[model samples]
Target: MILSLIVAHTRNFTIGRDGGMPWHLPADLAHFKKTTMGSPVLMGRKTYESIGRPLPGRLNIVITGSPKPSDNATLRYVKTAEEAVKAAEEAGAKELFVIGGGSIYRQFIDRADRLYITLIDADIEGDTTFPEYDVRDYGIIASEHFSANEKNAYDMDFITYEKIKK
Candidate 1:
């Protein structure tokens, strides 16, 4: 199956501050929803805990070393990122969304074929950061620039990068 990493980060690659996103961009969120709507989204335990519940409209696969979820049918648990991806593939998924925290991103960075990155122009204090990317290794397939209002503050660019042949 084809794998992709989808995340919105600041220009400096900041993703989260205190277990949640530092900035809010409605357009970016809408773009995320549209892109991963019917697909299987794979995430680490920390990422899953940060959200508190499974996001609707997509199959949520959480990678954890834990036992099992308590009757939460929406949440599927796996041991590792590869296993999580395998689970998605077994379900006939063509693309797997690697929505993540730092560790998971690091784990799957080299494995993903594409990255759907929303580059936020503003920066805030953050703890979690995006994985390091080499521009020469990937080609920007698409992009959309937008700015949020006072309620959701941030100017962002939704950019898609596909890995270029080495």
Candidate 2:
């Protein structure tokens, strides 16, 4: 399966603070939903807890040390990132999106086949950040710029990168 990561970060690569985002961008949320609509999204436990519910249109595989009682059909708990990938594969996923909260991103970034990044233009203060990675290993396949508006909190650029195959 294609392993992809979808994230929104600032210039300093800050992704979260106080267990939530520093800003709210409806357009970004819409973009996220559209991009991952039919794909299974894998996330760390904190990421799942922050959202507090399963995303309606796709399988939500959460990686954690402890399992929770789950009655939600779309939600599944896995002990490790490897198990998360296996769950997605077992569910017949062609693509698995590693949506995050710091540590989770660090674990699978080296294996990522693709990245969907939204660069928010602003000074964001956060405790969580995206791990540093060499951009030269991936080529930008797509990019879109959106100016600040009523729906979007800040000027942002949506960039899609695919790993440069050897």
For each candidate, what is the lDDT? 0.86, 0.93
TM-score of 1: 0.93
Model 2 clashing-pair count = 0
Clashing pairs in 1: none
User: Residue 118 in model 2: shift from native, Å?
Assistant: 0.3
Q: Which candidate ranks first by lDDT, i.e. highest?
A: 2
Task: For model 1, give the 10-residue run with minimal summed lDDT.
Answer: 66-75
lDDT of candidate 2 vs native?
Answer: 0.93
Highest TM-score model number: 2
Question: What tens-digit string does per-residue lDDT give for candidate 1 at 1-166?
Answer: 7789999888788999888987767788789999999899988888888888999978899988884855766568988776787789888899999999888989999978999998888867799999889978999999887867775687778889999867
